[model samples]
Target: MRKSSIYSVLFGTVIFTTITAALVSVSSNVAIAQILPISDRNKSENSISQVNVLFVNPSIGNDTKANGSESAPLKTITQALRVAKANTEIRLAKGTYSAEMGEEFPLIIKQGVSIQGDPGSQGKDIIIQGGGEYLSRYYGSKNIAIVGTGNAKLAGLTITNPTPRGYGLWIESDRPVVENNTFTGSTQDGVAVMGNAAPQIRNNNFYGNGANGITISGTSQAQIEQNTFQNTGFGINIAQNASPQIIANKISGNRTGIVVQASSSPVLRNNSIFSNKEDGLVVIAKAIPDLGNSSSPGGNQFSSNGRYDINAASATQQVSAYGNNLASNRIAGKVDLTATAAPVKPLSLLTRRTPTLLNSRLQRETVTPQPTVPNTDSQELNYVQIQPGTIEFTAPGAASQSSSLPALQPASTGNSALLPVPPDQIPASKTGSPYMLPPGLSQNPATIQPTPQTPPQITATTTQTGSRYRVIVEAVTPKQQELVKFIVSDAFQTNRAGKQVMQAGIFSDRNKAKNLVRQFKNNGLKAEVIME
Candidate 1:
């Protein structure tokens, strides 16, 4: 019995040893398989000599038979996009590439594809222009120049001439790396981000855009860094509950440096915001942009703005609690907070309190700032006050019937309203009352006189500082109008209540207004021509 027991134990030990050795061998193989370094993987994937690499040259390449090689390159980017597979590298040579040749627009850059331009020569070599009328309008059907799907890369390229709502690059639901790109003459946002897209946008230039340089909304978290915005409507407009990292940007020569609206909470740091037509940063709605971190507040340089440095006064229109961290910014103007719903705690409570310009080269000293006071400008929401001078209002097509909007004319001064009007100035609706003007002015149509005066010394309203309203056609509840006023501001001139479900614009031609109404309806927005 003892011998049998010893034999059983020996058998069990042998079995256990054999099992352990086999398991160890399998584990070693698995570990080896998982041991690829990130850098090595990237190098292998992004290798230019890869089989899927394609080339595009507008001047020399032909689209019909080219296999995307250097010797026989493709003509248009559209053609390359169609044939290129995942991980494909589309290299563009020195030339102007347009989508007019092939009607494919809103050029979709597929996942894992990289579109590169000659970077050593500074992107002047490659120009990608979206030149169709339908593609240029920001809100047009085909307005976007490029749409990055995800995991795509665009480097060292110049994109220009996209119309309204048309974006130079519209990234949706993707993590794309867009670097060293120049965007100019975009009718709307140069770059528009939506969904959970967290794109790395770096070292780009945006100039002369009709709308915001970068507009990130709908939960996007873009890392926008080291970019320059000049002559754009707004440097960046963050809205719709999005949070993005805006760092080390030179936002200058724009209408507004940055507008944080809706429920956005952007991370702003180490940026130079100066020389904007409006405020350096305009925080409206419930936006709470994090301007600093724990150690020493995010220090940004703000100067030469037309209005206050940080205007959080948007709540004055409709009272709502808004909070923002303005702790460590080197502001040239006041942090206007008089219109906020609740009294804000001083920035000293949240910061370590260093006053040095950490990023600015010009100044390095710790300076104690002056006491911040609220904007003492008058709160007139309805009208912008101008100095005692003439106001001009020319009808779109009828120059002879040109006159100033009398309703906008100040009621205080009769001399405040002076515009040249011909004998046929009055519309047919007011033919009986020929002297009928907007609300407060009275003149005889029979003897309408002209007065030539110097140009008006225009002054902005408290809410609308140095900005004019444009006519909009849309339908919204009175409360929702506030949201539309900031988001689609070009749609309406004033925040006045409309009579019907929709409010239309000022158009001289009935056919144009009808066409616009049809276009709006086509886009699922109710619109009609309601001539005043």
Candidate 2:
């Protein structure tokens, strides 16, 4: 029995040792399966190249062959633009650089790269001037743009004197932020943005240009805030199916200020629009401006205008006016009225076929009724023949005379007071006493006398200051109406309104108008002087 027990214990111990060994082998295999392959781990650890190019003063005239460093840098924005790839930084030093004329030297930034200007002690004093004529085709051909796919930031720089035909900065790329810049003296628009390029344009001053200050088109989104548009043809023109939020902008001294035309839906809030030529704020036929208390505060103010203050055909579309100040206009505060109502609903199976039927119904309900002609039997007879010896016939038929005429009296009573006649009454014939004018003169007649003309009295007096100049008068030709238009347009550019001033008249005496023209010129004006 003892020998059997020892043998059983030895057997049990052997079984336990065999199980333990198998479990240890399974655990080792599971640990190995949890780890990634060596080849895959090696691939994940690979690094991408990140480079930074510096543009120093010495390298401004160098080529890309030199190392892009502070001591030796590549000259010309064109070379740096070419070698810049994704995840690259091209730093521009503070200096004045002249872009070559007719050259397509656009700095095209690739996706995932940032070409930031050096925010050194100089700040954004880098000035890029285009060397070309205003009308030259090559004017704006040499500007910088982030055309490649990705996000870009243009910070701290002054971009001026672009080619006349070109814009100061043309942004067609997507999601760019143009901050803290001065755009001035371009032949065309100062800053033109097209494509679906939605950019954040803020804290900019656009002044003194041949065309609009900031022209934005295309189906782009913009947050245009705290910008000043002064002394241009049109301050800020939003057209071409573009919708943007224009808030807190000082738009003045332009020909036509804030022209919201086309199919644009701009949320104009708290903007001070004043001193324009035709109207301070003009909304054409198709503009659907979302203007109301829900928009912005201190609504648009139209004051001291040459014509209608705020002009729109009617508020038919998506335009709503609330808490706006409309004051001081020659004509009506607003012009052109057309009844506009909500769209109609289809009542029948063919309702869609007659889309305008609902609009017609609303119009009919609001229109005034027209007068109808009376029937012949119901018409009041104006004349009735009396007997030859009748008292009524001897005097005159009451029906044939005016409503003020009195009934005829008996012949025995010769009181002239009974037949009262008006002081200015005219008899039927000249041979009769107090003869009335002939029928030719009474009804649709000829020989109309000329009424005395009343000259306009100038009540309000305005004083303009400028240096006095005298030039020899060659000819005193009558001032053309177009000349007045040009002068008014020039005045609009100089003032804060940025609107065209309609010329009241062109006086032959240059001395009388000299003060006004001088004031305009001193304020950066454009006017013409013609001798009388």
Best by lDDT: 1
Highest TM-score against the true fold, candidate: 1
* Candidate 2: tens digits of C-alpha lDDT, residues 1-532: 9999999999999999999999986774343221236665443223111234435342244663444445456565555566565545666676655554112333455565554554342124565555332221212232232232346655555555434233466655476666666555443456666556677777776655434566565555566776777655457766544566676677776544665554455555567776654445655434555443321222555566435555443222434555456643432223322213211111221121223211233222222221121122211001111111001001111111101111111011110100112122111111222211211111111121112111111111122233322211111122222222222221111221354333322332344345334423422334444343
lDDT of 1 by residue, 163-277 (tens): 4234578776768999988776554456877667889898988765544678776567788888998765567877655677787899887656887665566667678888775
- Distance (Å) between predicted and true CA of 456, model 1? 14
* TM-score for each predicted model, relative to the true structure: 0.55, 0.47
Clashes of 1: 14
In model 2, the runs with Cα more than 4 Å from the true position are 1-50, 56-61, 100-104, 112-124, 131-150, 275-278, 294-309, 313-318, 324-532
Give each model's whole-structure lDDT. Answer: 0.53, 0.41
Ten-residue region with minimum lDDT total, candidate 2: 386-395
lDDT of 2: 0.41
